[model samples]
Target: MNYITCSQGHKSTGGSNFCSTCGEPLQNSNHYLEPTLIGIQPGTRLRDRYIVREMLGQGGFGRTYIAEDTGRFNEKVAIKEFIPSVQGTGALNKAVELFQREAVTLYQLQHSQIPRFWEAFQENSRLFLVEDFIEGRTYESLLNERLRQGRCFSEPEITKLFQDLLPVLSYLHNQGVIHRDISPDNIILSGKTGLPILIDMGAVKQVTVNVATNLQTTSAPRGTSIGKVGYAPDEQIRLGIVAPNSDLYALAVTAIVLMTGKQPEQLLDQYTLTWKWDREINLSLLMTQVLNRMLAPRGDQRFQSADEILSFLGLRQTNPAYSTPNYSGNSTPIYQNPAYSTPNYSGNSAPIYQNPVYPTPNYSGNSAPSPVNNSGCGQIFDASIPVPQEIKGWNWGAFLFGAFWSVGNKVWIGLLCFIPYVGLIMAIILGIKGNEWAWKSRRWASIEAFKANQKTWAVVSLCLTGFVFVIVFLASLGGS
Candidate 1:
């Protein structure tokens, strides 16, 4: 999956002509090209069937690309190149075997949302998997577009989001599959069907993480987080343990972000370990209960399966209230509900869901480039020295305070805000790149320390923004 930065410094998935965040036209130069990491060049032929078109994106796991399959009349497909970080040819060959074996299960999975796995092959000492190419923007982009319009996702759309995606989850889970990484970036709104299609990474990310952990330098942190920092559950993050509910927990996090136009760090209370989003938006009591249960800190406390959630959504014919969904003429995509063909599962309760769709290495090459240095948001991020994914997202403090926020974070590049017109662009850049730049430039004791510093700035920025808004409103009223 490739990524391009828009005028607002928003990093959007590749293959999109417009900015997913700001909806601005993207220049070709803005399409991030890795100044390094030559995995495969364009026009390369593989298996005498698939021809490489261009590299889409890369990550700590591997790189993903778009290719033309000659066997299928040159239909475009996604190709993931897995280069394990481990040393030794014996280990590499064994890893390839595990990868091919895991690909078999993915081949068995047939669903409307999951991209079809074509085949896995090894050529020239490199491993590759061919998959269906989904043409559309990610849910992250869709939500960003909504935010650009001065609003967030409506309750109606979010309800339908669950309605549309839950079945896909049920299908995968019933097949004994668990999607450990589920976030808005991994779920794409298909251009063909307008349905949220899940593009899976399956064992690909597992292979990447396992290999790196064994080969990592002493400076590396203990234990690895497979899912995004905020979206993934605690067990998955702390213990590398995963279950069906892990995916559900992430789905709730995605919903909260889209529903309130706020990220996890902003919504969660570190001290109280509680969500503070009730005042942000008004949701039905039932919906709130579902989210809270799914977001339960402990895995055992949350719903265990997808069907349980479907049933709890008032899916029973006896309950017409939850049966008839509310439509508010909003542009959010709502699909035809799946028939209530319940699957055989033991536990019964409402569970949330999640999977990935970043444009760089999206299990099928679907995430943004993980920055390795003070890399510009528009530039290709290095995979070798990966940056922490936690700090990635909009920084309200950086956006509001402009150059002042830069001075505090020690991201001196942001000080260009002193210039008149450049100040506006600098502010946008700071908001997007501030956290990452600060992480790289300054010496923080830990990720927590770094986030703590920014969170305080974020609170202050919010208050200042609100104060300025009030003053402007009062002045307008007096003039009127």
Candidate 2:
């Protein structure tokens, strides 16, 4: 198949005359292709498996592409082409080694919101990292769409986003992974699940920068570093230092940008290192207080961990009956937990290092460790109120939708589906525990209302599952 990346980053596959995604001309005298990195071209095969489809986007970090993996039954993937802005063959080799090292760590991450990191390889004197391709618009794209409609994300929408995403962040931080980059462009809203999926690990970018700086002969290129100008914190940008809070700073900037439809430069005061975002728009005092602390110029002043942010937002799962402060975003929430105080991470400059090992695809009786510590869940359920026997059954919706369903219903355990190897087992567990978890977590009008909602979800999920099976059947017949 001949492929060419059109000006709009759309690929013309299947010998088409026009681009498949945007209807752009494949070979027109009038229009030219979008400016892409030199060397890597469309239709280029790498590692005898991945067929490059189009250059999705390029950045200071690296060039990203939409590719098809023939080995994975033609599954689409996002491949990052690591182009070190450095000189010398020795330096390039060092960079590749660094890239692989960081890639290994990224590959270990298994969170529902994070795209699965697949493989890291050196091909054609270039380094590439493969990841699951998300079929959705970036938050940046979504924000632009909203701006076009003469509005931006509302306070409540942004609040819900914070609620949805903070747990994912807590999961990453606990796993000793720092995204480094947490801007709107990096957060994609998955079309299939309608959940925000975090993409692009800046650890790769940081590795390139470290190689360039440490290796005396190999001078690092300006753009090869982790910090984005406005999104990055003072310590990250001015000094080469980062912590879990650094990501929180970027996330705050992203929220404000999405809410105000303004750039960080517009919101922040250059001299005082204070944000004037409130001048532009008025938000609830609680939200105002939260964003201010997150956007604080000093790293120590910001929320130390993503768990802290989740705590502040009252999103953590906790026992409702206990007068000892439980997790409830509604019904007079608890702002802080007595156990969770601001962590003093004064000495820790980078992600906490864990013993890295190759993942063996085996399931022990013990389930894969979840990213976020939601142990409070066990205590959340009341002993007196027994689960209704009438509605207790395997949940088709939970089984089918996985984390997508779990997230909506506040069943944190269902997110185990995002775990590296134990996801299938977790899906079955979700089906079994779905009804009980939902009953405890949320406040429904009545048991009837709860049953009705679950029933509706099951119906929709079954219909969608059937539709997918039919598509696969037709495709298999066509191939045969």
Scored by lDDT, the top model is 2
How well is each residue in 69-94 modelled by candidate 2, as lDDT tens digits?
A: 99999999999887666644566667
lDDT, residue 304, model 2: 73
Candidate 2 achieves a global lDDT of 0.68
The positional error of residue 344 in candidate 1, measured at the CA in angstroms, is 17
The residue pairs found clashing in candidate 2 are: none
User: Candidate 2, after superposition: displacement of residue 450 in Å?
Assistant: 52
The regions of model 2 sitting more than 4 angstroms off are: 1-39, 214-225, 317-480
In candidate 1, position 406 carries an lDDT of 81
For residue 18, give model 2's deviation from the true position in Å. 37
Residue 425 displacement (Å), model 2: 72
**Residue 219, model 2: Cα distance from true site in angstroms:** 12
Supply the global lDDT for candidate 1. Answer: 0.67
Give the CA lDDT, 0 to 100, for residue 230 in model 2.
91
